[model samples]
Target: MPRQLLTDELWEKLKIIMLKMGIYDKPCLRKTVEGIFYRLRVGCPWRDLPTAFGNWNAVYKRFNDWSRKEKLMGIFNALVVDPDLEWEFIDGSIVKAHQHNSGAACEQETAIGKSVAGNTSKIHMAVDACGLPIHFSVTGGEVHDCKEAPKLVAELPKGDYIVADRGYDSEALRLQIKDKGAVPVIPRKKNSTRGNDEMDWCLYKYRHLVENVFARLKHFRAIATRYDKLKRNFEGSIALACGLLWLPM
Candidate 1:
């Protein structure tokens, strides 16, 4: 049997969520979820899944159905019952897209872009005070962090402060955060004359929390490197990884 990622304890918690999603009562559902987790962990082709998990095609179809309906995302959000809102951090990371990511029917929506790193996708994310992922969005690699910030900021729950790196230095964004009743703890760019005199460096230091969440999620091979051709599937993989982070809480 292939190495399983879900412990009985984790499965017990996840099973309740799955049951509520109406997918857990089906035959071999646990194995099917294990099969999906295996693919996310090992980054293998669906057809290459170990037979111990059952027929590979059946597993892939089940994952695809869930991805299309965004059940995985629902599961992730459902797990995030309450999050620390004292401070929040936002950041972006690029994931190298494998050659196998090619040939998607809708290339434009695949969130892949040609950059110095070749094909890539970018993840814009926000984490709560405890460094747990609260929300995130995916975009093409070449997309700027600020370009995706507004949507992410809007989705994030209100907090006392929102921290980010200089890549997100923008007067407009600062105002948006202020409008949302949170202080924007971003440093001014080196070229900016206004300076960071009033910037909360202490709170800003915690920005690493967002980066830490990214690092943890990237431990899942399917997340560190994109294997899913479609954007939704890739997001589903990320959602599952993020949801697992909240399972222990």
Candidate 2:
């Protein structure tokens, strides 16, 4: 059997959330969840799940059911902290989609899109000052970072400052962030006719923290490369990874 990803300490945290969410009544909840993580960690097809975790079909069905019902995201949110509202950083990353993971029925609504990388998807996210993710949205890779900035900032739990790279430099976005009562720390574009946005260079240095969060999350194979055909499944994968990041803290 393969090594388990759900250690006893981690299981203690996960089990409580799952139980509260009514994940399943069966006794082997640990194995089932570990099975799901195994697929995410290794980026393998569900049918390849090791027998020690249980039948692959049953494990896949349980995950599918949860993903469809948005229970996985619920589990992630249940364990997340009430994020610090002082400073927030936002950014986006593109992941190449595996061809095998494409072509599902109703897949048109998925975040997959044609980009320079061929088939790809994007994970747009925001992180608190501590560099922990507070909210995220997945979109087609071809979508520009500026296009998604509004949605991410709009959903943020009221913060004092919002930071991002030049990719997010836009007058409208800055005004939107200001409307939320948060100062926008995004840099101004060189050629733009608009005057300076009065950025705080010192605080903007922390924008890399959000990038760091994405880097850690991509260490989980499922997130580094898009292996799921459905958008919700990919969302669930990200949620699980994010929740685990909080489980130990």
Candidate 3:
């Protein structure tokens, strides 16, 4: 697929951000840095990086160095546009882990998790109405979506309306959400016999927005399948993808 280059204005903004983050101090040139980010945003393999950006090895080295320093996540967090409203959606999506992501094989116990698809990693995400990601967490696919709810919601600003699904239904989860001063709009499971609690079906429909956000995230093929061996790089790519999503299209 053909890729879009950053506009001059956006490129200038990126340069400013990189300079502030001390990424421009190295031997890496402007073209190299831009190429690295381009491949990241486009979700293409490093070897497939367009020649216009500069040597692919140079771009990949810069990317790896930045990943190690956690600079990418910093840039992402700094660039994210804050949500204009006080409502958010929370959900988790499973990404199949690739063999290449097994560099930390010794730490396999830490990275591998069970999912419906067998072994996979789970990404817990919370996004605002505009589909801007606010907070995220990673765990083994075996972990229940509801298990990641508290941590995801904890990062959200207090008093926001958090919409979820029936899978998130649980008294403890509801209490945690309420404790944060946010209303839990998750529907009750069918097996629930509780008569006092009720769900707003109208609000439930909007929960699909989170699903849409996941769909956009997976549009980046790199994120669709894990390639980065380290958990941090894997997660950094996610944050980068989120940053691109927040950018004005």
Best candidate per lDDT, number?
A: 1
Candidate 2 residue lDDT tens string, 52-148: 9999998998898898989989998888777787999899999999988867897346889999999999999888888888889999999999999
TM-score of 1: 0.97
User: TM-score for every candidate vs. truth?
Assistant: 0.97, 0.96, 0.87
Scored by lDDT, model 1 comes in at 0.92
lDDT of 2: 0.88
Q: What is the C-alpha RMSD of each candidate to the true structure, in Å?
A: 1.1, 1.4, 2.8
Which candidate has the highest TM-score of all?
Answer: 1
Pairs clashing within candidate 3: 114-141, 114-142
Better of 2 and 3 by lDDT: 2
The segments of candidate 1 whose C-alpha lies over 4 angstroms from its true place after superposition are none
The residue ranges of model 2 lying beyond 4 angstroms of the native Cα positions read 194-197
Cα lDDT, all candidates: 0.92, 0.88, 0.75
Count backbone overlaps in model 1: 0
Which 10 residues in a row give candidate 2 its minimum summed lDDT? 191-200
List model 1 lDDT by residue over 25-94, tens digit each.
Answer: 7779899999999999989999999999999999999999998989999999999978999899999999
Spell out the clash pairs found in candidate 1: none
